[model samples]
Target: MGDEIRTILEQYALQNAVKHQDVPRAGAVIGAILGKHAELRSRAKELNAIIGSVLAGVEALTHEEREARLAEIAPDLIASMHEKREKSSDLPPLPDAEGGVVMRFAPNPSGPLHLGHARASILNDYYVRRYGGSYIYRIEDTDPKRVVPEAYEMVREDLEWLGIAISDIVYQSDRLGIYYEYARRIIGIGGAYVCTCEAERFRELKLAKKACPCRDLTVEENLLRWEQMLDGTFIEGEATVRIRTEIDHPDPAIRDFSAMRIVNTTLHPRVDATVYPLMNFSVAIDDHLLGMTHVIRGKDHIANTRRQKYIFDYFGWKPPHYLHYGRMSIEGLVLSTSSMHQGIADGTFTGWDDIRLGTLRAMARRGIRPEAVRAAVIEIGCGGTDISFSWDNLFAKNRELIDKGSDRYFFVQDPVHLTVKDGPEQTAHAPLYPGDEERGYRTITFNGEILIPGKEMEGNDLIRLKDLFNIRVTGENTAVYAGDSLTEIRAAKGPIIQWLPPDQTVPCRILTPEGIISGVCEAGVAGCVGETIQFERFGFVRIDAVADGCVTAYFTHR
Candidate 1:
C-alpha cells in the first residue's frame, strides 16, 4: 500500500511538473490518490506521508531536471498522458461505417451560427475526417418568413473560420423539385394523403386516435388534391400533405405527421413555389438522395427521427445511422435566434456580433480562438443528457492555448505618474514571450518617470518593477530607488508591479465582458490589429482596430 501510494503521487507530481513546471498541490495529490484507491481513504495519515515525500522530491528538482527524471523513470506514463489528452477531444468511431460515410451540417439560415450550432458542425466534421468520409453543408432555407438574406453567407463564413472543410454546399430551396417528386410518389403509393380538414378539426381527430375523412381518400383523389395544392387552389394553412403512420402509436406526435404544406411563397426570401416540404420530410428525402450514411444532431429531434424513419420505410430506403447528443447551454448567454433578432431590432443589442451574445461572430470578436471552441465542444461529445457550462470553463481552455503565444506588454489603466528619485537612466528590455528567447524582446528607456495603474498603488510602500529594479513608495506619486539585489527583493516579498515608460506608450482601450477599459500600452502595440496579446498582470486581449493614436482591443480572458 505504501509503495502504491508513492507511485501514484510521483506520477501525478511528474505530470504536474511537466505541464506547469511546478509540483502538484498537496490537496490535489491526496484527493487523486484517494479517488484511485478508495481503500486508502481509511489510511489518510499514511498516504499523506508518502505524498508529501514525493512532492518534496519533485519540488527540489529544477524544471529541466524534473522533466529529465520523469522521462527517464516513466517514459510510458508521459506517453499515456499525451494519449489520454488527445483521446479526450476525440469522438468514438462510427459503428458499421462500412463503404464510404457521408454526413452533413444542416442549419436554417434564419440567424448566424451560435456555439450550440457549432457542436453539431464540429462533431460531424470530426467524425467525417476520422473515418475518411465526406461532409456537406446544407442550408435549410425552406421557411421564407424567418430567413435572413445574409445568414446564408454568415453560416458559410463561420464554418470556414472554424476550420471545418465542407466537401459540398447544398441549398434545400434549390431542391424543391426533388422534394415535390418524392411527395407525389409517396401520395401515389398511398403512403401519404392531402388533408383539407380545418386545422382545429384535424388536431381534434389526431388527438382522439381517429383519422380524418381525407385519410382514406383514393390515390387518384389525393393526387388531384396535391395538384390543386401546387396550382393555387389552396391557400396557406388550408391544406397539408401528411404521411400515413400508425394512429394507435403510443406517442400522439407520431400519428400522421405533416410532410408538405402550402406556404406563402411571396413571403419566402428565395423560392416562389407555393408548396414547401416540412423539415422531417425534406431532410429524410435529402439524406437518402444525398447518400448520407450518418446523421449527427441534438437529441431534441428524437421525435423527428421517428417521423423521418417512416419516410425511409415508405420509400424502401435505408435510414442513416443516427447519433443524437444533448443540447448544450452556456450559462448567461442568450442563444435563441428570435430573441437575438428582437434584441437587435429593439436596440438592446448592437448586432449579431455583440460581445454579450453567444454567436460565433461574437466569440471571434472577443478574441476567443476557433481551436478553443472546437476543443470545448469536442470534449462534451455526443451525450443524451443536456450539458450546461459557464464562460469560465471556456476561458480556462482559451487561456491554455493563448498564454504561450500572446506577447506580454504593460497596460496602465487610469494611469498615475510615478517619479523615481535618485534613479539612474537605464534601458529595460522585456521579452515578448517568457521562456521563448528566440522571439526576442522590446525595449523601453526609463530616465526618471513612468506610468503605473492608480489602483495598484494603494497598499504598497515597497514594490519591484518587474524585470527591473526595486523602489520604496514614500508618497502617493513618488518613489525612491531601493537597490537591485535579488536577495533583498525576495526577502522583502513586495508586490511586483508592471510599468510603462511614458515616452513609448500608446493610447489603448479594451472591451471587456463587464465594460470598456481605457488605458495606455507599449508603443510596439501599434499595427498589431487582429493580433492577440497579453496585457501584463491584466488579461489577454485581441487588437480590434488601430488608428488615431489609439489601439482598440477586446478582452478575451484573464
Candidate 2:
C-alpha cells in the first residue's frame, strides 16, 4: 500500500514540479493527494515524510526531466499540466447557473452576525461574485419575538465590514401585506386554511395522521377566520393559518405546519403587527418574490425546506436550487446571542466587541481580516459533513494576509529592568519591516538600561537582545552587556529576546481572549493606532488606541 501510494504521490509531485518549472510545492502535492483520498489523512505524518523524500528526488531533476518522468508515470496528465486549473477546488459551482443567478443572505435581525453566520453569507456572496449578479441582503425580522431593534442596522454594519456590498436591501417586516396576499391566494386555492384548533389538539391529530375540524372549513369560512385573525378578533394562540400537506407524511412536523399566527402589535419594536408569518412561510414567499435563483444554507433547515416546498407547489412556483451544508462547530468561542447579551448586561463583557465573543465585530477588533474569515469559511466549502473547526485555520490565513505589511515593534510583558553593567548609551535602529530597509526604520535611544520580559530570565544565560547588543544574565533583574556580534550570539546558542529602552517606551496593554497582557512598547508604536503590527518575540496585535501616552491594543494572533 505504501509503494502504491508513493508511486501515485510521485506522479503528482512530478506533475506539479513540471507545471511550476521548479521544485513542487509540498502543500499543493499533499493537498492533491488527500483531497482525492481522504482516508489516508490518518497517516498524514507518514505521508508527509514520504512526500518529503519524493520532493527531494523531484527537485534534483531539471524541468525537462520532470516532464519526461511525469509522461512515463501518467501520460495523460502531461497534456493538461499547462491547462488552466479546475475551479473544482473552490466552492462548487452553483447548479443551473447559466443565465446569471440571483442569491440572498437572509439573516434574521436577532443579534450581530457571528462566524456561524459567515459560512452561509460567504458562500452566497462567493457565488454572486463568481457570476456577476445581484446579491440581496434580506432581513427576516417578521418574528417580533426574535427581533432586536438595534440588530437591524448592526447586521448591515457587520456585513459591510466583511466586505459584502448589498445590491438590494429587503425587510420582511415591511412585506406583511405581500405575505397576506399570498396567504389569501393559497387559501382561495384550498391549499391552506385557518385553524381554530387548540395547539395540543392539532399536535395530537398531526401525530395520529388525522385532520382537525378546521380541515373541512370552506374557503369563504377560512378567509373569514383569516380576516378575524388579521382584525385581532382572534387573539394570540386562538387561531393560526396552516398550509395543507399530506397528514400521513413520514415527517410528522411537515403535516400542516403553521403559516401565520396572531401576535399583539405592542410586542414588536419596529412595526405594528397583528399577525406574523412563520419563518419557512415568510422565507419561501420572499425567496420566490425576490427571484432568488439559489438558496445556500445550513443542513438544519432541511425540514424547513420540505415545509417551504408546499408553498412553492401550491403557487406553481419553481423552487430555487437549495444547497445545505453540514454543521460547523467553532471551537473555544461562544456563538450564543442570549449569553452574550446577558454578559453585556451583567458586565461580564465590555460589549459586542469583546474578544471572548465570536461576533465579527470582535474578530475585527482583534485584527482578523475579512478576507481571512471568508477564505477560512470558503476552504470549509459547502460540504454536508459536520466540521470541527479550530482557530488555527483562521489565524494562519490572517497571518498570511498581514505578516509582511505589518510593521514590527517590541513589547515586554511583566517587564523586568535588566541593568547592563557595560552597555553603552547608543541608539538602536530597527527596520520597520526586517530586511526591507527601503520601507524605513525606527530608532530607540538607550542609556545602558532596558526592559526585558521577566519570563525564564535565568542567571548566567547568554542572551541576544534582539537587534541590540548581546548580554549575559548575571543575577535576578540584572545582566551585563557581553558582546554586539550576531555571529557570536548565534554561536553561543543563547535565547534571543526583545528589549524596550526604558526611557523611550510607551505603556501598553493588549487585550486577548483570555485576559489582558500589560506591557510597554517602543515610543514609535504610539503613532500606530488603528494599525496591525507584530511585536518582536510576541504576537501580532492591532493598535486600538493610544491615549494619555499609553498604548492599548487587541491581540490578533501569533
TM-score of each: 0.83, 0.82
Worst 10 residues of 2 by lDDT: 81-90
Model 2, runs deviating above 4 Å: 1-89, 458-460, 485-488
Error of 1 at 540 (Å): 2.0
What is the per-residue lDDT of model 1 for residues 1-558, given as tens digits with 9 covering 90 to 100?
A: 667667767877887776754567888878876787797789888877677667766754544456567777779866665453554566777887855689999999988999989899999998888887789999998877778999989999999999998999999999999999999999999899999999899999999999999998999999999999999999999999999999878999999999999877457777777898899999999999999999999999999999999999999999989989887777666789999999999998889988778899999998898998888888888978888855666786787677777888888898989999988888888888765779899887887898988887888677777678888887878999988864555445455667887888999998775778988999888767888898877778998988888998988877
Q: List the residue pairs that clash in candidate 2.
A: none
Please report the candidate that would top lDDT against the real structure.
2
Model 1's alpha-carbon lDDT is 0.84
Taken over the whole model, the C-alpha lDDT of each candidate is: 0.84, 0.86
Give the root-mean-square deviation of each candidate in angstroms.
5.5, 8.9
Q: For candidate 1, what's the RMSD? A: 5.5
Considering every candidate listed, which one attains the maximal TM-score?
Answer: 1
Clashes of each: 0, 0
